[model samples]
Target: MKQFIVELINDRFMIAAVLLFGLGFMNLLLQKNLIKKIIGFNVMDSSIFLFLASQGYINGRIAPIITNGVFDAEVYINPIPSGLVLTGIVVSVSVTAFFLALTVRLYGIYKTVDFDEIMLLINKEAE
Candidate 1:
């Protein structure tokens, strides 16, 4: 048990990523406001990026850039995760912007950003 605790402490970034993911998932499920939901989505995206970055990093390895002509694979950390995190960030930002724009349009039409309120308004309009 003590060893497990130490290992967990050493892998703090992974633990933090998992905790952040859970928090974001809970927020996404429990929130009623459109803006809050979008924020939760962003949190989830960030957690995923953090997890990827942490997974790609090594204690003694350098970035995958060539230095002093050291053409050894073992000396450089994997670059895939860094690339993936960068791509994910771009996509996350675009998605977040789209969601916010949609929320704004909904607010303009219904005068409320709450999901329940919007449903109630729609139901009233239908009747």
Candidate 2:
């Protein structure tokens, strides 16, 4: 039990990622405001990035960059996860910006950012 607790403490990033993802998903699903939903999505994106970056981290290993005549895999951490997370961050930012733009346009049209209110207005317009 002590060892398990220690292991869990050592894997704090994974635990944090899971908690962040769950919180974000809950907020996204339960919130009625478009802006809040977008914020939740951004939170989830950050948690995913954290998880990915942590997966590539090694306690004592150097980066994958090779120098000093050292080429052993044990000495270098995997670079793919970090690279992918960097790309994901760029994409996440672009996507969040796009979503915010759409939210602004929706607010302009409906005069509100609440999802239910927007739906009601759209329905009333359709009728």
Best by lDDT: 1
Off by over 4 Å in 1: none
Count clashing residue pairs per candidate: 0, 0
TM-score of each: 0.94, 0.91
RMSD of 2: 1.4
Model 2: lDDT of residue 72: 84
lDDT of 2 by residue, 2-120 (tens): 99999999999999999999999998999999999999999999999999989999999998888798988999998999899989999999999999999999999989999999999
**Model 2 worst lDDT window (10 residues):** 63-72
Q: 1-127, model 1: which lDDT tens digit per residue?
A: 9999999999999999999999999989999998999899999999999999999998899999996999989999989999999999999999999999999999999999999999999999999
lDDT of each: 0.95, 0.94
Residue 73, candidate 2: how far off, in angstroms?
Answer: 2.2
Q: Which pairs of residues collide in model 1?
A: none
